[model samples]
Target: MPRNDDLLDNPRSPRVRAVAKLAKRDARSETGLFLLEGPQAVSEALTYRPELVLELFATPTAIERYDTIEQLADEAGIDVEFVTEAVLSTMADTVTPQGLVAVCRQFPTSVKEIFAAADGEGPKLIAILEEVRDPGNAGTIIRAADAAGADAVIMTGRSVDLYNPKVVRATTGSLFHVPVAVGIELPAIIARCREAGVQVLAADVKGDDLLAARQGGLLDAATAWLFGNEARGLTDENLARADAAVVVPIYGHAESMNLATAASVCLYESAFAHRA
Candidate 1:
């Protein structure tokens, strides 16, 4: 239960400033915590990983509108602290916090745990992000990976910070749904995938046509799709490390597809083949 009497109304309070500081990478790195903005992200955190949520803040109206969040929070033994709209906004990274926000621990899965093939239960399909600095693209790829039933996502050391607020928001609620391993070097990840018997397939424009791979029965194997930066794609050295390189064919007169769109197509291709 929350105490309305103790409503946080100060937008300039020390606590509010501390929470707002989480928007910066240094603060998040030091505190091992990140900000969860909007009702959707907060609700997902409460539902999927309540233990990681250090604090929950919401406007009285927000709790009323999203009463299920309150119920879930209560069930998880989390006490919601009612805050004024101004206070909520001060603690949020987005322009509009949607009247709810949360402080959650950053839980990054180790690459070894992700590639753990003990008992022959390793991941069949995985997504690896290399030097993917665009927060939106990285997040969407993670969402697409989850939607395609991929086992996990691994972001190379050169990629954007996994705890970036923009990345978290772009994920919607899928950030909570997928296991993401961050900060691992690309070469090490590829080696681990090889040991796990997962073929690393680099998604690059210079690669073999995706249709050819599908026709060759390559998509049905335990595979890890490597996606690179939005602008540059994969470097030649990195591409050479892959078991194979694949390109999603562009059938239309359109110049090019967005990285996330191309990634979804590639991931779903494997998903379809796995089930077929």
Candidate 2:
């Protein structure tokens, strides 16, 4: 058991108050950092092994429930602070507070860095999301991409911020496992993929190709999957740029699948083809 300090007792401390207020977009933008609340999210952050964790707060009740986390934090030399329930609730996003939260520095990544990290081999499996406005969907896609062993995740146009608390929570810590490049120009990225011999496949409801059966025959050559926004789907420009359009067959009279579900289906299909 780690000792609880005075810092935890003062919920209105300048830093603690700042973290509480900084949950807003404007404050996060100003600081280039975001707040992560809940035990699950904080546990995932530990896996990332962040170089600088500003603070760690846990309610006594939370420490009792998550003994493993407490032990891990002690081993990692992380200081644990005990806060009042009211304080914890103020910092939490949910009606029921999980009793753990942490503030961490943001690490920005770029396309050049990703290419360099790949040792010039180029990404064999990439997922490109164009203007996905929902943070939950975006985070889920990233988590799926990581699970499918994708080389990278590219966000184009005006997509949701990857570091949004909702997105971070959705990723469940897969955010650290994957390389994400945001605000990329779609057309230019497509051209770069073509130059690298990566086949660009777009996911479209009206696509002529079926995703699963095409394995080892048509889609075997594709190296990347492109997904678009939920409401409008892919734009004409994106569709025109794709080497091929792939669609998942839906039955039982559903209008369409959710964006995150559609992306997961397509990514898994590509993974299957690669294995085949």
Highest TM-score: which candidate?
1
lDDT of each: 0.91, 0.79
- In candidate 1, what are the lDDT values of residues 18-87, reduced to their tens digit? 9999999999999999988888888888888899999999899999899999999999999988999899
Stretches of model 2 off by over 4 angstroms after superposition? 1-13, 117-120
Tens digits of lDDT, candidate 2, 1-276: 445554356667776788787667787778877777777777777756645466788888888998777777776788778787778877766678688888777765687765553554777788998888898999999999999988889888578887788887888778777888887899878887887788988888768656454743666664778888889988887898998888888877998789999888888877877787
Model 1 lowest lDDT segment of ten: 1-10
Model 1: runs farther than 4 Å from truth? Answer: 1-5
> Model 2 TM-score?
0.90
